[model samples]
Target: MKFEIKRDRLLDGLSDVMKAVSSKTAIPILTGVKMDVSAEGVSLTGSDSDITIQTFIPAEEDGKQILQVSEGGSIVLQARVFSEIIRKLPTNEVEIEINGNFQTHIRSGKSEFHLIGLDPLDYPHLPDVQEDELFTIPADLLKTIIRETVFAVSSSETRPVLTGVHWAVKDGELVCVATDSHRLARRKTKLESVQDEEHNAVVPGRSLNELNKILDDSADPVEVVMTSQQVLFRSKNILFFSRLLEGNYPDTSRLIPSEYKTQVTVNGRALLQAIDRASLLAREERNNVVRFSANGSDEVEVSSNSPEVGKVEEQLLAEAIEGEELKISFSAKFMMDALKAIDGQDVVIQFTGAMRPFILRSALDDSILQLILPVRTY
Candidate 1:
């Protein structure tokens, strides 16, 4: 196989596919990137069994040549070394050629390097997913969904299912929920096209996080194909595949309270700032708990005390306070995360009780909700 390609374009494709490459894989071939040179373009693929990514560089785009293929064949090269060599190449173009013994030759400008290549036939084939069950979503909106919920996924391996974000679609409405038992984040949005079929999948948080980094923040549509075991995300020149978690995701609908006893409205930025200050003292404590109290007054108090450190107290004026007076203590980290995920300036916090999990939502947007369980502080 032989090909001469634009250095920047090759680097772009390598940077994206490298996210799926792992050096500690059982299959040695999986540590390298598979490159296929064809008359149409050049294809680069990387996989670590759980996830696979492929990117293409067209031969000609907009009347400009991006690649020139001398022969059509396939080979695999060490991902890390190849990427580093290409990145440090002194020229804007790179030439690669493979011999009968799988010896790969790379040349650019005044530099040259040789690498032992692996036979592409030995690499595992990508999962064949039927695209019949396909849906489309705006790339920017998908990123928002990931940003809001993926952070809440559990880091513990005790409950493997909680390490992923649950995604369900019904009647063209898509809802994503993530929780680690202590806090939960839920985001909902309407699909561009209405469909009658129902779909549910638990996608690993690690996969979503990596996909978010590759996707551009734009209104361009991203096509998604789902099977029972695998999910595919296709954008302009990229294809991302992730295995769905095997177990059923726990039902999270019942966890959200339908009613509340105490409700307070406050500026989201101000509350975040106050919590930031209070957390400085709370951080010294083991649980990082912060005290919050409201007594149907115009102002609410946020305070934290640490025996070894010091105490912090702040009173912020609330726009409205209704229902019963309440005093609750919660993880400062959890509260800050929920507040930051909310989009609007005005935030409405509803409490079922001092001990029950409280809800936080933007006053203008009902599609997003955040819940945090309060801690016991005598």
Candidate 2:
């Protein structure tokens, strides 16, 4: 196999696919990137068993030549070394050739390197997903949904399903929910192309995070196809595949309260800054808990105390405080995360009780919700 391509173009493909490569992969070949040279373009694939990413560089685009293929064949090269070489190449052009013994040669301006290649035939085949059952979403909106919920997924592997974000689509509306038992985040959006179709899938949060990094913030459509065991995301020149987590995601609907006993509306940025200051002391504690109190006043108190460190207290004016007066304690980290994910200048927080989980939402938008379980502090 032999190919000469624009160095920057090849680096772009490598940067994206490399996100799926893992040195710890159990399969030896999975640690390397599989490259296929075809008459039309070059294809690069990387996978660590759980997630796979493939990107293509066309031979010619917009009447400009991007890649020139001398022979059509396939080979695998060490992802780490190849990517580093491509990034540091002194020239804009690169030439690569493979011999009968799987020996790979890379050449650029005044620099040359040789790498042992693996047979691409030994690489695992990508899962086949039916494209007929797919739906499209705007790339920017999809990134928003991921940002609002993926942070809430559990880091613990005790309940494997909790490590992934639960995605459900019904009646043209898509809802994504993530929780770690202590905090939960939910976001919803309407899908124009999906009507009668329904889907329920648990997408690994790690996969979504990586996909988010690769996607550009634009209005361009991203096609998504979900099977019972695998999910595929296809964009302009990229294909991302993630294995769905096995087991039913716990029902999270019932956890959101239908009514609230105490409600307060406060400026989101102000509250976030107050909590950020209060957390300085709270961080010294094991639970990192911050206390919030609203006593039928225009202002609410945010405070935290650590015997070994010090105490922090601040008061911020609230836009509105309704229902019963409330005092609640929760993880400072959780509150900050919720505040950052929620949009709008003002935030509405509804508390069921001092001990019950409280919900937070943007004052201008109801499509997103954040819930945090109160930390019991005697």
Compared with the true structure, model 2 gives a TM-score of 0.98
Off by over 4 Å in 1: none
Q: Pick the candidate with the highest lDDT.
A: 2
TM-scores for the candidates: 0.98, 0.98
Residue by residue across 159-221, what tens digits does model 2's lDDT show? 999999999999899999999999999999999787487899999999999999999999999
C-alpha lDDT score of every prediction, in listed order:
0.93, 0.94
RMSD of each: 1.1, 1.0
